[model samples]
Target: MPLHRIPVTADLIRGALDLETTPDGGLVPHRLPPRARARNTDPQLAAVEVQPSGVRLAFRTRATEVELEVRPTTRVYAAAPPRPPALYDLLVDGTLTAQSAATGGDTLTVDMTTGATELTPGPPGTVRFTGLPARLKDVEIWLPYAQKTELRALRTDAPVEPAAASGRKRWLHHGSSISHGTDAASPTAVWPAVAASLGGVDLLNLGFGGSAMLDPFTARAIRDTPADLITLKVGINIVNADAMRMRAFGPAVHGFLDTIRDGHPDTPILLISPIHCPIHETTPGPGALDLPAFAAGTLRFLATGDPGEAAKGRLTLVTIREALERIVTQRAAEGDKLAYLNGLDLYGPDDKDLPLPDDLHPDTATHRRMGERFAERVWGRDGSLEGF
Candidate 1:
């Protein structure tokens, strides 16, 4: 069939933290804004922050069939286990209708042991969805959460237009990789996305995979972005990065909140502590990738810091949660519309049966559970964010 080709331009995409034009007439989704991008020089951050965690392309169409040409950069870990194939999700009128995966694109191979990287180029692959209703309705193509994608083109049987404004509450969220959709089935299945769907909110997910440090640039970006509600899922990234001590963490949290408040003085802000991470619960981090497990084709994480270090002010999930609760309490006393929620409330002790496969990121089922819990606890009628 001769299909009508629509260029994949920035106007067609939404939920992206940032959009970058590719030299080859394509668009790449980035989870970090340009200003924040310049401040973080880590190559790892550069790669993962562009993984399209909650990013999706939205349009209105009456077409019964749709297709997209994508140029993806798939990562390959040398001396480590192979990763799963990336997937693209199709949603029609807010309902997940179909999913597709391309065969090839670019391959980035990394030798974790040697700290070396190599890129092997590949061509774009096509993804198609057929048998739609034909009535004009909202359509969304959610890119892979674990792969960096360069969208080349879109095709539909009928004309496509931008989706109408949902007029939903804007919920701006910032967190680590887990919130960035690690191990999620698709971009739309990310915990935050799930929560947003259940809570009836528009999500601006700033969940940078490994770059959710309390950077001033990030704070400024959040402050500038208009939002009805805001949430910061902190601690895990700081601990995993070994970025700060207890003293520094408290002040940094305060500063991050203060920056956001500069623009959204009364916007409801929720501070979420780290979820249950056995390794980092008592043991301090810097966590390391478990090479042995990785070599065996399974990704695993191990906290390397001494448990005794907690007494010395080194941060652990437990210690960080305590600190966060205290800070939020003190701030709330000052009349700030801020609240604290322990991450475990979303994923915790009772979830032992649903183990996090990598011992770091939650599994698909866990993501769904967390999302449902979050929506009920924060956005529900009598929830913490009730008035906001």
Candidate 2:
């Protein structure tokens, strides 16, 4: 039998697989099975692609890429079964196309007008994206939210190019709903994304909505991930979930940091207190709504009175402040490379005076303001958040 070889071109590659370029010149895999979809219910899937050097994924246009040198050993492990209705708009050769949905299993397939093609299959542990466009200079994967996804490994068929000599810094942040951006209109609008854009640094957002409970697993996850600068937003979720009190809060913070420091000995670790929420601001968490009424849409969870007054002696704001203060002071005394930022500085009592209809999450405007405040306080010139 004679051997036949087909020259690979962008058009040919485009014809074979269901993929598209994003507005920011990145490739997005679409028509994937439901499980691998981006979690946001919003009809958008960020771009995912391959570059000569490696793969690049972005959440914001100005977001930084966690480049992995593609080798045979390169394997990226992102949280699968991404929030669904996977939809992405791509910009290929200046042309726009919509790609949708991603499925996961032994085989991952993407659909295009051309046909359905295999994206991942064969080896139980290995997934390959082949037949790429030749003009590919860079590849990017945009996430739907400002949350961190682990890239366990990365490898390519050929040796990857040397690292770029860019002067930009990388910032890794971990937080709860505020940082995860529960209500942001788009991924790019998230606080961490906005801050990363303003600061001109790469970001690894470990912000997980309803998931930042100062858990050891999460802390270990943060420590395991690589970063140049790190920040952890604590207290809000703990208070909201009523996960812990003064007694447990301090030790949890310490243990969390201790785990991270073990992996990143000298990395700058910032501890961020919770942003202002009128309901939980002065109250202890585990607050409940009338489930039945809430479901019926007849009830509203508005913070009518001073939350502090309501919480009085139970789970007061003063208690959270004291707990965080003690943790920072103790860590500082031990010469640990940790820094603490008061949530009030970001959004305090004064801000709380404003009405929050939802009483829990902040509106988009508030999110923007919070991001700006964080940038100013932590990344400002001559800021105390230096050399962490």
Candidate 3:
């Protein structure tokens, strides 16, 4: 069988380039590259740095004979950049397609026509790239880069389509860095991506590295977006960032879910807690650690242990487990359209001995394992994803 190929051209570059700036002045390209370009040009540059923001790209094409190619995906390529940071997710048509970590790269493709394209990163330094479509009338790119990187130039050769849509249901996931695939080797290798591929479902990954702290804005974002199956990997960020405590965590989660339910009333919403992090798992409250950095070496984050403040409530693994159990119990009784998956079930104490090196994120193999487990335990037998 011959593989289908989409063509490429230069006319796809007009307003299709978007850029975001980080706290430290640096550029991040969000859109995909054009199919072809003039012999010499800067490839229609869009630069960005640190603080999170949005970039847009729109295209109009009249060449029926032309196909498009967007290449060399760009986004936050490093995890720690010598400063506090924020992560971002790239969205196309209100659906999250890719996310960038302090150290991650994702490429998103979209059809032509101006719509809402958003880029939201965690903090400090992160980058996001939006890839060009295989065919287009006009193209637009959005960049949200918060650090530094050498974006040699946008290059494209051919169209790349992993699979064709076949009326299958879609799986949408929103989580912290783990779901954003912090340590995964490639976009396709991320656990969510892997699970989506295996389950034969379309994917809308809203994972935003350190940004999944049960924020109302994020929950509203998820609510506004449409999906057949939805999963939110919560806990890690709330704990790591020390965003809330037990007293507030419960209401916040309820509120977050309430907002999401407003839009996806019938969709299955799976709430996943934090994966195993030995350092903080047993700790009583807010804490941070200096682990091997994502960039060349080691990095340190603010580690504070304050039991007398709001930060204390946000810390602790026990708090997470309690809050999750409360939500699950409350919702399950009413038969509300929501479910819960324990983080330990995904990565438990039995798996803790395995070395992560980074101390925060899992590696590729673990990602694969996690994806398989998610499919087998959550998606395979569940009727919710049967149509997908």
lDDT, candidate 3, 1-388, per-residue tens: 2223332222321112234333443343332222211221221112211111222222343222222122223332234343223333333333445555434333222211222233433322224343534453232232222222322222223333222234767677877668766666655557886687567676666666566666555566567676888888888777776667688788888898889899988888788888877666756435454443323455434335543443445467756876797897799788777777888777777885555656678877888888888887776765355422
Candidate whose lDDT is highest: 1
lDDT tens per residue, model 2, 53-170:
1112321121121222111211222322232332222222222222322223133343322224454433212223333344433333333342212222333333223223335676
Off by over 4 Å in 3: 1-164, 284-296, 299-303, 306-314, 381-388
- Candidate achieving higher lDDT, 1 or 2: 1
Q: What overall lDDT, based on C-alpha atoms, would model 3 receive against the true structure?
A: 0.53
lDDT of 1 at 37: 89
The better candidate by TM-score, 2 or 3, is: 3
Ranking the candidates on TM-score from highest down gives 1, 3, 2
Question: How much is 170 displaced in model 1, in angstroms?
Answer: 0.9
Worst 10 residues of 1 by lDDT: 379-388
Relative to the true structure, candidate 1 reaches a TM of: 0.96
User: How high is the CA lDDT of each candidate model?
Assistant: 0.87, 0.51, 0.53
Ranking by lDDT: 1, 3, 2
Best by TM-score: 1
